[model samples]
Target chain A: MARVYNWQLGREMSYWYPESRPKKQFAAVFDTNKCIACQTCTLACKTTWTSGKGQEYMLFNNVETKPYGSYPLAYDVKLLNMIEAGKWSGKTYEGQTIFESAPAGERVMGWRPEQVDYSYPNTGEDDCSGQVDHGALMQLPHMNWFFYLARICNHCTYPACLASCPRGSIYKRPEDGIVLVDQGRCRGYQECVRGCPYKKVFFNPMTGTSEKCIACFPKIEQGLQPQCFVNCIGKIRMAGFLNTPDKARADNPLDYLVHIKKVALPLFPQYGLEPNVYYIPPVHVPASFNRQLFGPGADAAVETYKSARKDMDLAGLLCLFGCSESLMTRWKRTGDIVVGMDDSGTQLVRVPISEPVHVRTSFDPVQKLVRINCP
Target chain B: MRRRKLIVLPALVVLLFVAGCKKAPVQTTEVIAVAAAQLPSSPTDAAWDNVPEYLAKLIPQDLVEPRLAQASTPEVRVQAITNGTDVAFRLRWLDSEQNDTAKPGSFVDACAVQVPTKLMPNPPAPQMGEAGGGVQIVYWRADWQAWVNGREDNIKSIYPNAEVTHYPFQAQSLEKGSPEQKEMAKRYAPADAVGNRRQSPRQSPVESLLAEGPGTLASNPAVAVKGSGVRTQDGWAVMMVRPLPEGLAPKKRTSVAFAVWQGSNKEGGARKMRSGWAPLAVEEKKP
Candidate 1:
């Protein structure tokens, strides 16, 4: 076994392949609170990449309502149940992850989902717990608590898809840490599909191969953000390169959110894959529930996000979300506004310190007519 | 455990022969390519009766199993004949379960033959070949054969009750003859749409492929090999015929390898039963 540092796990972990450190790792932060389940990101990804014949059932990027919705219908729940059946302590997993717990002669412990499993992509859409009684105006903070979770391939530091492929067809690019399946090499084993805990990898029976998100590498290479990131209507996504935790600088929005302020935490960090995508846990949800999804850092991340407005740097970083077509490499507070800039130092966007107010119109029953007035 | 017995039993037999200080007759099975009086019209023709049979022991591919394990057809009786123009192989394997259909998670029974591009000092790795060493492969699929024979009970036949209310590229669609239909077909089934029209009987179920190591196998695109299979009470008898490549001279000694996949065992890719290299020699007709 080869050992490598997993910043998310805050320790080193073992892997079958030798450690391959990319020049810059692809990273993103999604604020679950701001997502509205519009699925613009999902459509953007589908139209741009996965609109092929065997890809009819695939959604490289999907927006599912959390605690209820799943694409392969409870893919996460099944894996989580398996992990729970094993040993786990606090933030550290004592037993094996899906990759480590593979049976003898197998590369990873995986399950092949039947066709019926994929037949329903959104089996439990918008299902929330603790519903309020009908005809009741009593609004409780805990009632009707569900959020949209926009998911894509994590492009993990230790991708189970890459490790599980017996033919060594799946690989992570050394430049950006984007995991991809080599079409020519893949033999449609579906092992990658089976081994992926997130079920992001898909098998194309037509071509007899497996495929996954390429991270919009073509667009990224042209200095533009991924289609999903740029087209997100909720503006909850921020894509950039993650700096080493120790070397994190305030100028980098990703660094500030993940390393300095520690406001973004990886989803299921206990899986030990050091997944690159981070999430700012929803503040309204219970801490224990958030902890189950984002690990022990949930409470701290929520607190940091709640207090973000008081800190100019944190506030500016928050404003950087979905602000530009290009990947934001740095940001700064200029006067009363925050400006995000790309690697070339070109300003991509500027947001005011406080949102500007607008006038509105209202109608009164006595007048029986529409009225407009400045507030 | 079966693999251990396969290795240990052979070694023990060899040890006993040596310990007895007796001259043991070495039994060798050779596939002699005969210049047929006349080539058999079909694989199941009476001409095949004249050919001698060779027993090949099939071993589990434990190198990549469960992660790669599936039910494997343990042994196959092979017979080969050549008309100096085309070479045909009749492979009979015992598989009580005849699995021919494929579904989302299910597999189809298949078999393949591998021969090196040139005779090597040491045979190419049985698991397709080593880097820089090229191998020619003829792969036969039971599913394709069923389709070629126009057998009902294909995928659509198996799921008889499946109601498809809407399909994007249905024959009735406005884009039926347009490029969009071609694109959709290509995405769904490249083999069907990409100029490779499926022909019954004439178009063999076997595919000709070339490989230069693991993960380097590519379809030859020539459709050079022809094959058919029938399921009997005991198992399947498959016949594959292909003209020997020009590189192999007539009467020259060479070798070929065989691999079998049992769909019932869920065997595919690198998970299947296979044999090491076996001797192959072709004979020229006496004037």
Candidate 2:
């Protein structure tokens, strides 16, 4: 065991191996407020990568309606309960991580879901917390609430799957920090499937091994966002590189949202994997519920998001999302426009933080014509 | 005085018994490898009748990581018959379930025979041996036996209704049986594309593994170690055949070890029941 710095926990914690970060960590920020549960990103990833013989149940990217829904049944709730008692002590978590909580002779404290656990990918799809009684909303506000939660492999800085593989098959790519399973080395042990708390890694029975989301490295190498990020219907996703706090740059869009403004937070940071994908908590969700899902920062993130329109830098970066197919390494706001640039400072996209508004009256006097919209 | 006489009476009887003994009682179990005209190819082979059988008691392998949480098989009966060129050993053990399918969160019945690669005045540690003195393990699995028994290794074989899509390698995506189609199919089956031995077709039901200490098991699929397993009424019976282990021949003294995994109990990899090294005393063939 080695003590490594987990930035999410804001303290050094026990990890299987010493901390060694990638040169450029592949990362993304998802705006939960903008997501509408329209699974365009899901089908985009499904048709592109997971539509195969053995991958029938594998959803590399899935959007579940949260508060009453989950893929693989209750993958999140189960893990959250397994590694329970891990409460945050202000910024630093005082509880043991999955690695630290592992029992004698085990690498990580984890449980493998039964084959039947995967039978229902969308078990509680679109279900809300409370029921609606006919037209109750007309008389009084309905209590029901749900939000779309789009998920992909977090590609952690300290990947539990990489640590639990007895044969050392799963690895975090040092170039991009993308966790991957080396197909040749893997022997269908399913230790990775058991180790991952998020239940992202899946066992492909046809191939007799495990497979997970590759983060679309091919497109990333070609300087483009992944298929899911580009195809997001609500423009809720932005793919970029995130830097650690010590080296965070204001120009980097991921760092700006994740570090500078400190609005976007990693999911389940208490698990101590230091997951790269960050999420801007939904404004409508209760702070208590959001805190458990995101972290102690979820309340602050939601508050910041509620006031985003007043902050041009925050609103500017949100506009730049899903506006381009190319990956933006650096971004900046200039007046009403947000310019997204590649690593070489080549402008990839220019999105206006505020859109121009033009309204026409019902009657056009000059042409002696009456114009009515949406009759 | 009476208590002393009672103790000395038994002691004098034991002294007479000790003086009558021809040689010192053998401390280690000597598995006499009776040189045979032909090795036993299967557990039911008649050639094994002429060879000596040694029953080894098994204990849960809790020495290393991923320790077996529970006990499964209690013991295994071992027999060895060797030809000059090749040696074959038969392992029979008690198991209630004949689990021959490998699935996620499930394991298959398996057994492995470990033979020391480096020999000398002192034998290596029985737990996969030491660094300089490694062990060559011939591992056999029930699922591989199913494969050798003509079971197709595909989704349809396991879940007949599973995975009915236009195979990316087929007509809809690419021309069937074309080079491009083959490459496209490999995309879906990454393990097979990279030639992971587990995903590849099985000619024999055994894998030849080399281990130098714990958690260092490595196997090359190219190296052939032939074996077969069959489900018995009480348990399982398996036969492992390979070239004579490094330093074994007629009139040679060596040792061997065994390990067993019960699939229904979720035993595999480091979680298993194993036995210590049982000395082998090779004997010349009778005319």
Candidate 3:
């Protein structure tokens, strides 16, 4: 094992291979507070990629209700149990990562779920953390709490799937840091499926190989976001590139949300994969539970997210989510409008700070139709 | 002196007991290879019954990464025969379940017979040979055997519950069996599109592979290797046929290795039970 630095753990740790980051890391920020779990993003990804035979059960992008819901039934809780929860002192994690805690002959500390584990993809769909009593009313810090967690492959800096492949078939693309299974070289070992803690990589029975989310590379190469991000009904997703902390650019929206504002945090940062997909923790969830799910900065992330309106630059970047299909490499706040710019300084889109609302009459005179609903 | 004897006596006894308890090295016996007019094509052919069976003890492969600990299969009864032009090997192992599908969370029962390309004074290591001393492998897979035995090789056959709403390869707009449709279908099955032998349709139950070390196994030129595997009451009886190794003639000795994988135990690749190189003494005449 080679010792490499994991910024998420705030320390250097052991990895199977040496640290060789991509020229540009494909990353995204998902605002958990805005996700409604409608699964439009799920369907969008499904129809676009995994509509084949062996991938019948694959959901490259899925939304699960946290605290009681999970795809593959408790994927996080199972791994977390094996690795055991570790302590975090401020920004530094004082714990054994999945790699550091691996068993004698194993590469990564993980458990492979049985086929039956994937039988129920929507288990505990809308279940809350606690039951509601009769005639219960909403209040601050209510007993019942649940949040939607939309997930895709994190495309980690040190991908467990890439590390665990004995055939050396799985590789991280040097161009975009997209971890992929070399379909031609893979012998259907399914080691990646077992090694990945998040259970993103899936075994394709028909092709006799493992497959995962490609991060919509074709669309990305054409300067567009992924299907799931573009089709998100809740507008909670924004896909862009993220740089390391030392090289974090303030103009980059992903960097602004992840490094500068510190509202978006990587999931299970203690795992030490340095997953690129960041999340803005749900504001209403308890800090303890959120911390366990998102890492030590969950409480601070929630605070910053709640007060996003005060920061025009931050709020402007958040408004650009799902605003356009094209990828915005950079963003800036100009007056009351936020301009999304490409890498070549081309403006892709512009969104106002506040949406304009014009009240319509109850009855429409032009169409001669009665309006039952008022907007 | 008396105290010393008392202490040393018990210590000697403990040492002897521990040595006895440890597993002894498997006897690498020289097994007889029966001569035949033509090598038997079937595992259960009457010709195989005439040959002596050599029980090769299997040990977990601990030489590389992803090693196995005490593989489920402990031993495989091996029988070899030569017809000058070709050599055939029959391996029978006890397994309760006949696992023949390679799917999600599933593995296939497999076995391989490996021989050095040239018979040398000192043969290569049994762990898939060493650097220059390459080993030619005739690998037999239960799934491949099933495919050659007329089992359908399609998604519907493997997964009855599969709901394929749309597959560009099977799109109604594309004419059936057209080159354009095949080109479009290649996108869904990347492994098959890129010509992965395991994913492509095959008529042979065994694949000819060459290996010079761990993780160096790859396809070799076709050498007219044939195989047949039959499910017996207790386990599988597989017959593998291949061209005779170099420097092996009638009334001669060569080296060979055997490996077995129990699919139910999730064994494959480096995680399977293997036997060290064993001597194979070929007979001059038919038994």
Best by lDDT: 3
**TM-score for model 1?**
0.81
Order of candidates by TM-score, top first?
A: 2, 3, 1
lDDT by residue (B1-287, candidate 3, tens digit) is 99999999999999999888834323336666678788786987877766777888999988876678566799998888888778899999999998988876788899999998788888898999989988999999998887787776568777767555667667788998899887776766667778884743578889899989887888887666889899999999999989888778766778988999999998877789999888877778744
lDDT of each: 0.75, 0.83, 0.85
Query: Where does candidate 2 clash, by residue pair?
Result: none
Q: Which is the better candidate, 1 or 2, if ranked by lDDT?
A: 2
Candidate 2: what lDDT?
0.83
- Across all candidates, the chain A TM-score values are 0.89, 0.94, 0.92
Interface RMSD of each: 5.3, 2.0, 1.9
DockQ (C-alpha based) per candidate is 0.20, 0.39, 0.40
Write the residue-wise lDDT of candidate 2 on B1-287 in tens digits. 99999999999999999899755312226666668887776888767665567888898887776677778899888887778667788898999898887777678899998888755557788888878888888999898888788888566776676756565566675777788987887777777778874733588889898888876778845446788888999999999987776667666677789999998888877778999998876677778
Clashes by residue pair, model 3? none
Cα deviation at B33, candidate 1, in Å, is 4.1
**Candidate 2 per-residue C-alpha lDDT over A109-212 given as tens digits, one digit per residue, 9 for 90 to 100:** 88888878877776546544336456322332323777889999999999989988877888888889889999877877787888888889988766678899
Candidate 3 C-alpha lDDT tens digits along A29-133 = 999999998999999998788876577878889898877677777899998888888999989999999899988767788777777878887654564424556
- After superposition, the stretches of candidate 1 with alpha carbons farther than 4 Å from their true spots are A83-94, A129-144, A358-375, B1-35, B38-42, B64-67, B96-103, B131-134, B146-204, B210-213, B216-224, B230-235, B245-253, B283-287
State the TM-score for model 3.
0.89
User: Could you tell me how far off, in angstroms, the CA of residue A175 lies in candidate 1 after the best superposition?
Assistant: 3.0
lDDT of 3 at B123: 88
TM-score of each: 0.81, 0.91, 0.89
